[model samples]
Target: MLSDLPIRKIIHVDMDAFYASVAQLDNPELKGKAIAVGGCETRGVISAASYEARKFGVKSAMSGNLAIKLCPELIFVKTNFERYKEISKRIRKIFLDYTDLVEPLSLDEAYLDVTKNKKGNPSASLIAQEIRERIFNEVGLTASAGISINKFIAKVASDYNKPNGQKTVNPEEVLSFLEHLDIRKFYGVGKVTAEKMYQKGIFTGLDLKSKSLDFLETHFGKSGRYYYHVVRGIHTSEVKPNRIRKSLAAERTFSENLSSEVFMLEKLNHIAEEVSKRLSKSKVAGKTITLKIKYSDFSLQTRSKTLPYYINDKDLIFKTAQDLLYQEQLNNSVRLLGISLSNLNTETKKTPEKESVSVQLKFGF
Candidate 1:
């Protein structure tokens, strides 16, 4: 029965603690130490943490203050994106040597379709092993590889044996492998979705497979259809190599919460200016303008407007954000504000007239 399905050899490769590992590799003194790359212990959010730091409850997007509290001796290093980008390029080049169908999830992770590779190797498992070896030898970094028939399974399997390891799920073993997998472990299933599934008496892939399409659709809406197929080992989403940026945005967190509309308007103006600069630099314009607000209590909301014509001007972006800000009721003190443009026109290649005035406001509060 499974022979009728189109089988593709997809591989997901993920670097192990990319930024922190790079720092550790460059500085031997940092090895075996809890390291965080982003900001100092006083402020800023952690962009990445070493496995040692992770063991101490330090994680990315967490405040530096909290990270220090969790791991008292945590070493802090500023981000070096230029170096990371260079390393990412090297890794992509290595992937291209094997297959052109590479989809990068981030600077550290990518999905490669290698059913028929340049080496004429039929075994996806062997190709993944060689890729990992090549990355280690050439880039001096460790990567974990997951091999399976499709992207979803490959992504999940990559984490099974992490930190310079690999796991392969053959076509015949897909269903059996997913049966015992926890519902929370499924791709795209978050904490809230897991809780909802738990409440609905679904706790594993086995349980999910028991639900009929109509029942799942009636309960979970559009996502139910997704769950229904994924549980039965039926994911067909191809690896998109040249994924376009859906939106470009700039946001800042204030040191102190502002209750006054005047203060929010000032912050919004700065954010809008930064967004406009990014759009102009990319030689792209968009019709949709989005204003994002985060309250002092951490509650967030977004308001957006789509215009008939595309724009990349700072004045127009700020004006649109200003209108959206005034239209909504300020229910709570504001802590963060962001502006974004989407539905882009990438054909325009206009050179920016001036340098961008970008700002990074890190507020401990």
Candidate 2:
């Protein structure tokens, strides 16, 4: 009997070295050169690195000192987390323009479902290109995209081409793609799991497919069943929204309402990082950035910006808060700072149209 699961139109969009790319976009001097965002100081980590820096073995989460060691000339800068968040919001808003079914994988990557789309155009590949172009034109950054029949295939395909390229894996080609794939490349099969699979003679998708369901389940737990289907180019997960509140923030009450540049930057970055991690985990994106500050004697002021895009980058996020931080001068100094992001929406599949709401994804082949 044929399964009830219908094919889908899924596109995975990933910005090319998002943080570093944004920095490069803003500074012509950094163009085509290796750049890293985060503090240039010893304790800071590399927030993002350009392809050029990546070529030299620099990567995000690597220590700032080690990154500079890898590339003596690598440029290190403080992270503008607020700025990143604002820009991320703007970028995501673009996705919502196409479809409400966007599942953000990270600040720089997301899966869009265009299965039932608003755009009259039926080609997801074209839509991906249009989104990429729109991002470049509006945000001054470049992104790569991948289109496929499901999120599993689309996310993997997005990485096939990097730095402003787009690729698509149609349904007919999925089985073939899985057949030749290395076991290590299978989603959720990391080094340890791959080694375990190797011990079980599962070096490729073919080997995995050969394993009986009971045997796989017995050995690998619930994940084994997942792997079994993946080996066959099948996945049943849908783009679900309204998951849960990822985060709630608290503001510090200080001795006095404060106006301090160093204090505000410190507070905003911490909050943005906290919010970003939660959003990343929930696979969600937000379009609103809110800032809260209280004056010396207890006068409170709140500011927010609804970006035209969605984002999760800490630097961008922090910068936006920083902008809010300075937009109004504190009449009194010393007490309370808060940052929050609400109006959350998961960006999924999208098609190109100004007022398009949802995408209708259909597999061809």
Candidate 3:
């Protein structure tokens, strides 16, 4: 029955602790040390943590203060997005040699559909290996890859062997592999969803597979059908080359909370400039402008204005943001301020449907 399903070779490549790794790569003195990229001891969040720091429970998105508590010796490094983008481009150049059907999820990870690749390589596993090798030798960073029949499984398998490792789930292995997977490990299942799944007695893929579509849909709503198909190894989503940019935003977290709108004007201007620059670089305009405000008490508020026409000019963005800022009275002392432009003018590219190929057992690594 599984053999009747269509199969496409997909590879998910993820750079290992990309930001932290780049910091270590550039400064050999930081190698093998517990380090985190981004954030400070007092006022921000860690962007990425090295393996050494992970041993101490330090991780990305963690409060810098909390990370310090976890590992007092953790060295904090500032983020250099420009440097990361430079290296990411080099890695992407390598990917272009294999297939144009590459979908970049971020600067550090991407999904590559190499079923009909430029290199004419039949073994996706070999392509993944070669790609990882090139990234390390040429870019001075380690990457992990997951190769499988579809993007979903490939993404999951990539984490199986990480930080300079690769895992391949052959066509024949997809079922058993997913069947044994923990419910928490499913790609879309977050903490809340996992807890909900646990409540439904779905502890593993096998348990998920045992539930009927009606049961899943009844409980999980629209997501139930997705779970029904994916567990049987049926994910047809293609790797899109041109992923649309839904929004462009820039934000700043202040070291000290500001009590008045008078002080925020300058900060909001700077953020608007940044957002405008990003919009210009992306060569897109937006009709919607959103103002994000985070209060000292951790409360959040957003104000949005959608214009009839798209605009990306800094002055226009700033004016819109300024309008939103004064549109309401100060909720509380503000700790963070942001501006984002959405409802972009950029059009989404549609990928033409291709004929499905019968599943074939392939070489595994």
Residue runs of model 3 more than 4 Å from their true location after superposition:
327-331, 348-365
lDDT of 3 by residue, 1-365 (tens): 55766678999999999999999999999999999887888877688999999999999878788999999999999999999999999999999999988999999999998888898888899999999999988988999999998899999989989879999998888899999999988999999999999999999999999999999999999999999989989888888887888888999988888998889999999999999999999899999999999988778899999999999999999999999999989889998899999999885445466545554655433
Highest lDDT against the true fold, candidate: 3
What CA RMSD would candidate 1 show?
9.6
- Alpha carbon lDDT at 82, candidate 2: 72
TM-scores, in order shown? 0.88, 0.67, 0.93
Candidate 1 local lDDT, residue 207: 94
Highest TM-score among the candidates is held by which one?
A: 3
lDDT of each: 0.86, 0.77, 0.91
Estimate the lDDT of model 2. 0.77
lDDT of 1 by residue, 1-365 (tens): 34545677889999999999999988899999999998668766689999999999999988788899999999999789789989999999999999878889999999998876798887788888999999999989999999987789999999999899999988778899999999988998998989999999999999999999999999899999999988888887777776666788998877677899898888888888889888988878999999998886678899999999999999999999999998869879887788989888753434333222221221110
lDDT of 2 by residue, 1-365 (tens): 01345677888999999888878777889999988887464544467899999999999867666888889899886667677788888999999888888877667888888776668567889899999999999999989998887778887788788989998887667878878888877778888999899899999888888899999999999998899887777776666433345433434444333466887688778888887786687677777888887655546688998788887777878888888877877667745677777766633435343222322333451
Q: Residue 38 error for model 2, in Å?
A: 2.2
Candidate 3: residue 179 lDDT (0-100): 96
Error at 139, model 1, angstroms: 1.5
Provide the global lDDT of candidate 1 against the true structure.
0.86
